[model samples]
Target: MRKRPAEPPVRREPEAPEGCLTVAIRIPVRIVVLVLVVPVRMLWDALVVAGRFLNDALLRPLGRALLWLGRAVFVWPFVALWRWVVVPVGKALGWLGHVLVVVPLVWLYRYVLTPVGHAIAWVARGAGAALGWIAGGVGAALGWVYAALLTPVGYAVMWVLKGLGAVLAALGIGVWTALAWLVKYLVVVPAVWLYTWVLAPVGRAIGWCAKGLVWLVSMAVTGIGTALYWIARILLVLPALAVWRWILTPVGRVLAVIGRELWDALGHAWRVAGHISLAVGRFLGTLFRWIFVEPVRWVYRSVLTPVGHVVRDAVWRPAAEAARSVGRATRQALAAARESVRQARADFRRMLFGEPRRPQPVDRREPSGRETRTLGSSTTALTKD
Candidate 1:
């Protein structure tokens, strides 16, 4: 079996169809004129040129006219506003000018309002007179009605009074009899009943109170006697007791010294413990300050100070720097793309001819051998053997 060439071996253009390619069409002019290429840079260059041309040819004149029109339309209006409205308003507000303006307003007011006020006041006075007459008539009618109604009411009242007087006299007799009976029942009989039924217990209670008072008096007398006896005993024994106590002064001194020493030592010990506790509390407070507050202070200095500075620089300054760098890089990339395109054009020219100045003649010759050469790189050619 024949050996196949290795994969990815150099490729070659297919040979012109067996003998049918004896005649060839001239395609260089077509390729040069009718070819479509992705010339982004060329299009961009054309746009730039067109833009510059448009700015010079069209936009500049348009901008100048627009500026002049704008000056005419807006600038004059802006300039005139202070003079036309603001100055007029300000002048009208001045005292002398305001007084002059007020003259017309006052004249208008007098011409329009004086007659209306007089007419309204006349109508009001007429309405008041009518109302006064109606009020007087109503008053006379009401007075007559009141006098007529009073006679019947007075008669009814007199009749009622006569009946009431007779009934009252009868009731007076009964009331006197009832009052006399009630007085007898309430004062004489009930007093007798209370005296018979309740006074004995009251008297006994009063007697008991008297006995209690006597017993209390007796107890007070005994207490007073005891107090007097104690006072007399103290008066009688105080000197002897003093003498006896004086005799034991030396023994009391020793015992007092011992007791005072014990008390002083206990008091000193308590004071020392209290002082130590206070000092410990103070030291703990200071230690807490050292451990927590000092560290926080140090952390503020070490971290937050630098972090805040960095953040300020990053957020404010570095962002500006990055924007500048990106703009510069974009400009450089555009320049680099232009340079690459120029180099590619130069290379294509070199391949089409030999050099820019001296072009080589093209030959439409058929190659003699079965092997063909193809370009693999700009500097190298590959052959399929």
Candidate 2:
């Protein structure tokens, strides 16, 4: 590339006056501030004024009205209720509860519960004492029983056991000595002599004789047993089999046939009797229905029920009403009499015990208006009842 021509010397512009530049910058800033901040401040002021106006004109009055309404409708009424009704009722209830429940409970605990607890404790102590005494007596009785009976029995038993032990020991020693002597003298010597001299020959002869005799006897017995077996088989077994097969079998079959016939006859008779009984029962049921049930139903429908309705509607109802009226009148009269008696009694009591005071003229005028009104109302209530 060709060497770039030397760049022209850059010409810098002369700097503006600092005051003018500052003034120009401040003018724009002030214009921008005036454009933005002035309107914003005015809007803020207007909003504050509007807010104040709304607070004063709308919100304040609304709040005051709502507060007044709340006070009037809810708060004042609630306060009044709490002060006038709730407090007094609460106090009255508290007093009544104290009188009815707390006082009674305290009295019960003091007079009844405490005394009952003490009595129970005393009874428990008595029972414990009695049980202890019983235990002591039982122990004493056991000790006495042991001393009176068991100790002597134990000693006697011990002595008897000792005597028995001594006797048994003596018997054991005698038996041992006798056994030793007998073994030495009788058993060994006899066994040796018999083996040497007598046993061999005698055993041979006895064996030979016994063998012959056993053979003869076996032969004889075998013949006798075989003969007797055949005889018994022929005489008893064959006859028994024949009798069972022919005579007893026929007889049993005849008896079975007769029994079956008798059973069938009895069953037939039973079935006939059952049928007859069912027929008789049906006849009786029909007769009862005709005689008793129909007549009773007819009577009840035609006579008894109508009569009962008449009595209930005409006689009983009127009687009951009359009786009620009479009872009410009687009750009212009795109440009036009781009131008069009470009044008289009160008057007498007053005369007898009332405080000494200046005598006042008795107005003999017919009862006062209030008294007449009360009497009239009472009489009206009683008459309505």
Candidate 3:
């Protein structure tokens, strides 16, 4: 015997120990949930059964009929139109486009445009080479002119400007030195003395007064803010925090546990109700089969089948054979009458038109009557020489 594979162990979380409060809450919650869920579950199962019955008995057949009707009314006509009319028309149009437009465009490109493009390219290359040679000659002339004529003139201009710049720079240095000495005594020295002795002492004294005033104002503001902070914390924040921590948290936890237990119990009850509904349905089906179906089946087998066989053997076979005999006699009489009518019509035509000329047979084969079949030169299907 083959060894069965060992099943993997399922991992489960360790359950927390329940207190009296949790136990007290869970039991009532579960009972209430079960009571509430049972009727709803049973009703749900009943609806499921009713829906399945409707689907099988009515809706499925109706949908299939509608689907067939839709195919006949909508889909089949369009498919036939597409297959018989649209497809052929589209293929004809595609062939016409290929002949009228695509073929002409391809011919123009290959035979006309290709040669023209090559000729234009060759002309452009010649023009470009000519222009490049002319540009090179003009560039060489400009280089010679710049080196021979512009170089000496540019050097002479630069030398003259440099000498002038040195003279101007010497004069500028002397004027700058005189201006600096005059500015030191007339403007810079008095400004420095006034700032160091007069402005510095006044600015320092004003800054010290502003600092003292700011410190006094800040100290008053800080004392008031500190007092308000302590008062608000004691009156509002601390009470709200205490209520949240000590009262509301415990109440919320209990409510949460109750809700969780209620949800679990509802699920469990629904499952149990489903099993009960299934059992009840099976029992009812068995009872119905015994009460009605078996009796009908027995009647069909024991009573109806024998009576039908007797009727078929005693009455139906003789009636059917008589009907067939009558039909065969009728068909034979009609056939003889039709043959007499055709013979009369043929005799009348012969009297009117005289004897008709017989048609001569014409051979339609690859080799003419005068040609002989030779194995080495055969073109027929049997020998593809």
Candidate 4:
């Protein structure tokens, strides 16, 4: 046998320490809560009882009647229309659509469109094959022309162009050197002088002015922001923090305690009231039973029961038998009269119109009663011989 593992120790919760303030608040709060809650709880109980009585005696039956009336007025008519009118009309429309539209469309697709499509597909295949052969022949001819005639002409043109290019290169180099010398003296030298002496000084002055203006603007904005921060802190934040810390926190705690006590008192009062109401109801029920119910029950058992039995045996049974016999006689007489009337009608019809024709059987696919299949001679196709 193995040793059992050690059991875990149970942890106990620490109790809350109550102060003078909590103690002072609790007693008066509880007393006040109980006083306020008792009457409210009683009134609530009374309302619940009244509501239950009203629901049972009036509201439930009225709701059932209204429900029946609503079904009769609204739901039943719609149901009848759907069943008798709408369903039949919808079915007839569906059948007509199937016969008039769907059947013809299906027949056209199957018999007319399918054969036309096959013919078009066959003609397209033949045309595509002919076009492919023509394209191949044209491509081969173009390739042969490029290789045999155009190649030699292209080579001769390349040689002539190369000779002209060499002559142009020599003339271009001399003209390019002359233009470079003129551009350096007339345009490049003047542009460097204007930038170095005039534009550099003016740009440095404008940059210094812009930096000073930016520094002044930044300093003004920083000062204004700092002043606003301090003003808001003193005017709004400090007072709001003080109110929250000193006033609202304490008041909320007091209110929370009072609310908790009141809720507990209400629950307690409700339970107590329930017991009081149950006891009172039982007492009243017992009083009523003794005063009225017992006397009525005794009278019903002692006087009414015997009298009812006497009336049933002496008067009710004999009258009931007599009424049944009379009803049977009356029914027999009516049935005989009905038979006579039916016979008279039959005779009158025979005198006026002669005998009605009896239908004669016609030949059909299946065998008749006299020609049914037998074991000796089979009607099945495989065994006909």
Candidate 5:
């Protein structure tokens, strides 16, 4: 019976769905990873290789070419200019400056200025020496004249003054003595005699009367003074005292308090006004700087400076050159005139003196007798004249 039950397992077939078929595919993990990641990695590697190629093939050569071009166009030319043109030009300019300006300045200072200064100094020294000689001669003449005339005159005048003073002193003493005697006799003696004789009794009576009158006047004056004092006390002093005590003191105190308060208020107002004024002033300063000062400065810098440069170059430089030329011409004319004058002076001297004498060195020896006689005669003639 078990063998009959163990009949062949029924071969049951799965039923097919009616709509869509769903298929399941089995893939290896390595294949999935390779399918997802390999293409991205390969693309990244390709990009990197392409970039390296571009850098090596294009960028390196381009950078090198640009460097060489910059050197050829800019750096090399600049170096060459600095070495050949600029350096040589600078050296030549320096030499020209030394030759034209510095050398000329040194030459003028040494040859012209120094010689002119020495000539001026020598002329000054000669003039000074002449002046000194003339001054010495004049001083000697004045001394001789003073010794001959003024000394005796001064002594005589002094003696006359002394004699006159003595005589005046004697006269004054005698006059004073006479006046004193007259006063004693006429005034003092008469006064004494009159007092002793008739004037004594009369004077006594007058003095008594005068004393009585003085007493009466004094009593009247005392009464008047007392009345005036009392009147003043009642009319003026007491009223003034009362007014001061009652009205002026209280009014003054009230006024003082009011004035104090007013002064405090004024002080506060003044302080506030000062603060406002300072703020206003600051604001005005800033506004003025921006509006006036900055614009003026901008105009000066942008317009006036360039205009000044133009004026200097166009007008002043040419004017200065013309002035220098005129000055040079004038100097040449003056030098020629001076030379002509010198020649004329020499000719005149030669004509007058029958040929100008050669200059001789000064001798410091004592003059001979003949020379002394001639000098004295000339000095005498000059003094007389």
Candidate 6:
């Protein structure tokens, strides 16, 4: 209650220092801001408040508006400066959204979806292959059963056909054998007989006649040729021969006289030639018999001694045996014939008288057999009367 009590209570807020930046220093409202960076919004609201306050205090609205316009122009650089910060924040937000959405989706596909899908595909393929193999097996089995069922039927049919073929072959062979036998008896022999008896001899007679005619013609031609040759020789050479003979006739007579004179000389030469020829013939014969025949015998023995023994057992001995048998039989027969001839000579007179005891009167009769007929035979038989 003293007089000093009227002093004002001490202020609680700190006083803004001079010369430092302050809110109410009366700066243009456009230069002041509420947000730290967007000064334009705060300054615009502040300017509008200032204009209303001024319009209320004084009537200078136009001057106030001019001042506001001046302040706005001055504050434009600050508003423009905020774009760098805002644009960077917006771009950062957009990139964050892109990473959030795309990264998880790609990670899920790599870590989970791709392997799961491949495994599912592999399982599906394996199942499909299994089904295919089972179906193929069933189909193959069915085809095998079908083939196996038909095989026995085919074999049975083949067996029946084989049996039938064998039976038919046997029957055909039997029929052929019977036919061959019948033909041999009834046809072949008759045909051969007819040909041999009738046609063969006729053909042979015609052939012989033709041969004789040809031989006669050839002989006639040869005779004519010989005659012509003789005539030509006479024409060409007989005159020369006659001339030579006439010229040599005197020489020949002289030579005959010489021969008569030289008969002893020619006789001695002839005797010598004859004796030499006879001696040569005897010597050559002896040499040939001794040398060639003995050597040939030795060569034959050397080459064929074992061969002869082997062949004798194989072939030649049998042939020699047969020849020896024939010779022995012939010798025996000749000896018997000689004995019989001697006996017959000893009884010759008795046999002659004894044979007169009986006589066979000859009564020749004409042939009666049908085989004596003229033409067409199995040509078979000849009858002798």
lDDT values for all models: 0.76, 0.82, 0.92, 0.89, 0.82, 0.75
Stretches of model 1 off by over 4 angstroms after superposition: 1-121, 196-201, 204-211, 214-218, 221-385
Residue-level lDDT tens digits of model 3 in 207-284: 999999999999999999999999999999999999999999999998888788877878887887778778887999
TM-score of each predicted structure versus truth: 0.27, 0.39, 0.69, 0.58, 0.24, 0.24
Q: Predicted candidate 1: what Cα RMSD to the true structure?
A: 47.6
Better of 3 and 6 by lDDT: 3
Residue 315, model 2: lDDT of: 97
Model 2: clashing residue pairs? Answer: none
Ranking by lDDT: 3, 4, 2, 5, 1, 6
In terms of lDDT, the best-performing candidate is: 3
TM-score-best of 1 and 2: 2
Q: What overall lDDT, based on C-alpha atoms, would model 4 receive against the true structure?
A: 0.89
Clashes of 3: 0
lDDT of 2 by residue, 260-287 (tens): 5455545554555556555655887799
**Candidate 3 TM-score to native:** 0.69
Candidate number that wins on lDDT, 1 or 5: 5
Q: Give the C-alpha lDDT of model 1.
A: 0.76
With a 3 Å backbone cut-off (N, CA, C), the pairs that clash in candidate 3 are: none
Task: Encode model 5's per-residue lDDT on 294-338: one tens digit a residue.
Answer: 999999999999999999999999999999999999999999999
**lDDT for position 17 in model 5:** 57
Score residue 18 of candidate 6 by CA lDDT: 43
Give the alpha carbon lDDT tens digit for every residue of 68-103 in model 1: 999999998988998899888887688666587777
Per-residue lDDT tens digits for candidate 6, residues 1-385, read 6465577788799875643222233233222221222434334445766788888877586778878888788766556665777677888988997799888899999999999999999999999999999999999999898799978888999999999999999999999999999999999999999998999999999999999999999999999999999998989789888877887886786666545435533444445545655565578779998989888888789877868888889798889999999999999999999999988886997766664457776654443455475534323346343
The segments of candidate 3 whose C-alpha lies over 4 angstroms from its true place after superposition are 1-7, 11-14, 20-35, 68-87, 106-144, 178-218, 312-385
